[model samples]
Target chain A: MPLVGNLRDFALHDFLYLVDRGYKTGSLMLNRPSTDDAAHLYFDKGKLLSVVRPQRRERLGELLIRLGKVSPQQLAQALQTQQMNNARPLGQILVEHGVIGQRDLQFCIQQQIEETVYELFAWRDGEFKFQAGQKPAPDDVQSLVPLPVENLIMEGVRRVDEMSRIKERIPNNDMIVRFVDRPQEKAANINMTADEWRIFARINGRSSINEIADKIGLTPYAVSHIVFGFITAGLVEVTRPTGGQSSKAPVAAQAQRVGSTPTRRSAAEPAYVEPPKKSLVARLINRIRGL
Target chain B: MQTVKMVISGAVNAGKTEFIRSISEIEVVSTERKATDETRLLKKETTVAMDFGRITIANDLVLHLFGTPGQRRFDFMWEILSEGALGLVVVVDSTRPETFRETTRIVEFFNEMRPAPYIIAANKQDKDTAWSPDELRLALRLPEQVKVVPCIATQRDSCKNVLLELLYEIMETAKEG
Candidate 1:
């Protein structure tokens, strides 16, 4: 469908949906926000053929470590040894040394597809464009397996688009918008139910899709659908989550309070306790004490 | 004053180190040994890692020239050293036309790293029937922006011409920057 919107808005599932629906062949070009350079994803049929991005090869070792095939210490040691030998790739060396099993290494290589998706989504700037093509080489021991590139691209686009919609509803602008460029006003008179408006307000550019989902106690996919609807109506905009601006801290604090609460409280106990009225002197003392 | 770093790269035994030695004001720092196998027949020994030298063109401008090991085995290091370079001087051996593929690969690798300015010096012009600059460009399929300078690395004035072409390219890059 001529790769709509920015690739950063959609997530991995969206791409899979497209592929599953049988739209195959063509390259997907992804442009990161605030950057002119774009990454190209070549797809043959429903399968990914290759990914071309500058400086991406350097992250292979770090990606392997994150996948749990090799320990951080092992990677560090391998790098140190590589400075001396300079012949083999660090992953191959680790596999040879028995630090990680071949199967585990293979699994990590497979996981690279997802990791690539996450990395591409994490990009605050750049563009991704996808073009359709023939079916790619089948995944085998000899051939490299293609990741669900379309799914990742779709997920990123969906998230960014949703966040942009939510930011529009919250006029305060206190929250930092990460993925999308800037806050855009939603069209007035757009049809939105009261619940959708509440959901929109909570998007606030501060809460993640997960956070918004939990606050209203809805599934992430359902919340995504609502956000998508809001986006279509011009009631909100989608933005990518920025690093270190997570709303998880507040959620975690609330969780801790819930965890520490006593299970039972007497029904006879007063539900609301009113403070006694105080004189001017008492009020001053009370204010001081509160401070 | 900003210091600009440039890498001298080409195929194996393409006189990459020799070209650096000719233009550099200080003595070239290199590790050279007799060729061990078929490498001996091709040229002599090969540079292992890189060769470093400095040329102080003006009081404010100091060009740090790095000559990369020409063998394909050392291809990984190309990304490491080319990180912050201002330009590149691709030294091609006119004697061996078949090395053009490797020359193109090196140029493409540099182009991927932030659009740096580049010059291709087709060295060994003093030799018998060296290829003309047009012939070399056609064989190499270099873009027009990539200036092709013909030179015999041993000649003092010829080496200076190559350096001047690189300096002009760098100045243009600086203006654009």
Candidate 2:
């Protein structure tokens, strides 16, 4: 079990290489070739656990362009025009500028997908490394390829459901939720009932069950029932928040106990401030001042 | 006429302000002060918002160079500065290897901002015991696409080379799009 430095450090080719070789359990640490900053990629039985590229620090656009969705001219013009106007992306710009038609752009994107799959398939130089459990289906081309945006968005929504459940149980201040619900997934799952779907929709990982229930005008009990249904469907699972502590405080007496500490005083005092009361005449005058 | 937004970023005390001053035609406005922390050992003071410098490269091309604040606390300004940047030039102190993290963070931040093209200038390359561009690139683990140029920001020729590399990256980005 020799560990590689940073999975992120590996190029797309290297990542595909490990997967093709059937190396199931290992982490790939990725560091920029000329910088100290690094990111990690955890693989569980050849499945991606998570990719943690810090916020505001990944070059997804570069990757997208390299994949050949748009030409360099399109990117440059988009960037230059964007600097002046501050509207739209290079992809959109290409479409607007009539440099590349919508159909051509879409075709290029589709080609990029096929190319990525081909690259992943050609991971091994020359070896057929198959493992014991669940041999990947030969025709099941989906597994070898990167998940589509639709699938990734669905996974994101599922995680939000799990997060809401854990937040309900813990109600701890350390809980800070990051993922946004996938609207595309919600659009796809239109078959579910409105109320049932509302539960999933409201569970954005940032909102607790109670908060979600309040938002959707459902009782906490009703929300829990809908949540349980989602869990039974194998759509979600519970896990501790990624960072050691949750940012939200627990809703019970624990808040009081935590508040008792001097260090925690700074965290609690902000919520306790009271607005000064005004007399009825003063209130009326204040309201009338605007008129 | 096309306006190209360019960001200038580097580790603290890496002559980011002075670099801007050397090239900028406008008066450099900054609060000059003594070194406050270990960052001071490398250089002193910090850019708070973003240091803005404008240059007209050609009749139709106006390059707006935005310098970012070096400290981690000012990391938030990166998003604001990089809104529509065509590329970034990350200045590095070849003399101080420890500032590599700060430089990396800035580079990462730029990558995330918008697929803005970027180049790294191993600033102060004229100084004692400077690492070669290859060594710096290997040590920093920069992406293959990113160009790292060795230069002394204080020298006009060195600064011109750094600017030229950035222009080259920007042109390449344009051609690729």
What lDDT tens digits, residue by residue, belong to model 1 across residues A38-94?
A: 555566556664554543332445544433345556767877887888876665677
- Residue A166 of model 2: what lDDT? 44
Clashes of each: 58, 39
- List residue ranges in candidate 2 displaced over 4 A: A1-291, B31-50, B58-61, B175-177
lDDT of 2 at A128: 21
Fraction of native contacts under 8 Å reproduced by each candidate: 0.00, 0.00
Q: Against the true structure, what is each candidate's TM-score?
A: 0.38, 0.35
| Candidate 2 TM-score, true structure as reference | 0.35
Worst lDDT run of 10 residues, candidate 2 chain A, spans: A258-267
